[model samples]
Target: MLNIGVLVSGGGTNLQALIDAQKSGIIHSGRIVTVVSNKPGVYALTRAENAGIDAHVITKKECGSSDAFDAALCAYLQKMQVDVVVLAGFLAILGDSFLLVYKDRILNVHPSLIPSFCGDGFYGLKVHRAALDYGVKVTGATVHFVNEITDGGKIILQKAVDVLEEDTPETLQKRVMEEAEWKILPEAVELVCSGKVHV
Candidate 1:
């Protein structure tokens, strides 16, 4: 089984999805071994604790620099023998050291259909708001490999959701999470763990 290490910064809805998926056997050949959050008191850590998984908080203020923080995070994952690193709402920017160490072993779930409402500055509600503002008929989520450039990673899977005129960013975000993000993130993890996914 692949040892999965999840990184989170906020609510951890995606992390919950992975946990549920693993429990349901939707994510085969892998299990969440640890959860790391940059901020303390985040609900994600609570979820991990409730699930009896080892959870950690490594605040950036203590790390001194972004590179240092990334290195520290990578070290923790390596120590845990993590086979896959999933960025589930993890807001920290990982540097070259981390990226090079993890390489295609790292994955991220973006809230948009990628190449649209993605890249720098497009996160959380901002992605949905941009999609609504652009008047796009459909918007969804993308699961991709993590690379040097933000959200510029190679795409693994994408699932689209229809846009409704009455939808707000909050509603749209929820829809995308349910219809796309939550579903695919675990599947992508499974694919990688099962050796079906190629870099």
Candidate 2:
């Protein structure tokens, strides 16, 4: 079985999806063994605690530098023997050290289809807002490996969600999460864990 570690900064709705997927046996070969949050008192930690998963905190300010935080994160993940790292709404910028150590082992779920409203300054509702502002007929989610470039990783899975005429950023975000992010993220994890994904 692949031991998974999740990094979070917010509500962790995607982390919940992974937990639920494991419980349902949908994720056949991977299990979320730890959840590390960048912020304290976030609902994501609560979610992790309620599920009986080990949870921790590593605030950037506490680490004193981004590099230190990234190094600490790498050490923690290695100590836990984590085989896969999932970025489930994790907001902190992990330094190159973490990326090099984990390589293709780290997975990230982006709110929009890549090569679109992704990269720096495009996160959370901003992604959905960009899609709406551009009046795209379809906006979806992408699950990919974590590389040095933000959202510029090898695509594992993608699912498209239709945009409604009256859709707001909030509504579009919800729809993408429900129809795409929630589904493909776990599926991608399962694929990696099962040794089906080549890289």
Candidate 3:
């Protein structure tokens, strides 16, 4: 089985989805071995602990530089022999140094369809808000590889969710998470782990 190391920065809703998927045998090709958080004391860490997964914190402030943070994160993931890295609600921006080593091995789930309300300055509720502002009739989630460009890697899976007329960013965010992010994120993991998708 492949080892998956997840990176998180806040509430681990996506991580929880993966854990549930694993428990239900939706992801049998790989197992999540460790979870690293960029922010300490986030609920994501608690979720990791509850799932019996090893959890640790490595903040940019702690490392004192982007390069340092990347080095630290890469070192830890390498030490754990992680075959795949999943950025589940991970807010920290990874640098090229780290990206070079992991290359296509890193995967991330964006809240909105890529090339839309995505890229720098678009994350969390901001993505939903942008879609609403743009009056998009449909907004969804995307699972893609992590490259140097923001949300610019090859996409693996995407599931669209309707944009309700009476939706706030928060409401739309919840719906997208339930209808798209939670589903395809695990499916994408299965695809990557099972060798169905690759560079």
Candidate 4:
């Protein structure tokens, strides 16, 4: 079985999805062994602890530099023997050293379809707001491997969600999470764990 490590920086709603999916037998080829949060006092850590998963914190400020943070994160994950790294709601970008070490082993779930409202400065409700401001009729989620470029990696899975006429950024965000992000993220994880998704 593959050992998974989840990285988070927020509420961990996607982390919750993976935990629930694993409990339901939706994930069998791998299991979440550890959770690392970049930001301390986040609800994600609480969620991890509630699920009986080991939780940790490592921040850039503590490491004094991005490169050091990357090295620290790499060392910790390596020590844990994590086979797959899932960036559920993780915010900090991984530096080159870390990316080179993990390579295609990291998976990230972005809020919008890539090549769209993605890359730097596009995250959280900003992505949804961008779609709405542009009057898009459809917006969705994308699950892909994490590379050196922001949101630039091999696509694994994508699911589209309609943007309603009356939808606000907050509402659209909720709908996209429910209709797209929640579903495809876990499916993508299962695929990677089961050898169905290849780099």
- Measured by lDDT, the strongest candidate is 3
Candidate 3: residue pairs that collide: none
Model-by-model lDDT, in order?
Answer: 0.94, 0.93, 0.95, 0.94
Candidate 4, residues 31-66: lDDT per residue as tens digits?
999999999999999999999999999999999999
lDDT of 4: 0.94
lDDT of 1: 0.94
Looking at model 4, report the run of 10 residues with the lowest lDDT sum. Answer: 20-29
Which residue pairs does candidate 1 place in steric collision? none
Give all TM-scores, in the order shown: 0.98, 0.98, 0.99, 0.98
Please, what are the lDDT tens digits per residue for candidate 2 over residues 1-199? Answer: 9899999999999999999999999998989999999999899999999999999998888989999899888899899999999999999888898999998999999988888899999999999989999989988999999999989889999898999999999999999999999999999999999999947
Model 4 off-target regions past 4 Å?
none
Tens digit of per-residue lDDT, candidate 1, span 1-199: 9999999999899999999999999997999999999999999999999999999999889999888898888889999999899999999889888899988999999999989999888999999999999999999999999999999999999999999989999999999999999999999999999999968
lDDT of 2: 0.93
Q: What C-alpha lDDT, on a 0 to 100 scale, does residue 30 get in candidate 4? A: 94
Task: Arrange candidates, best lDDT first.
Answer: 3, 1, 4, 2
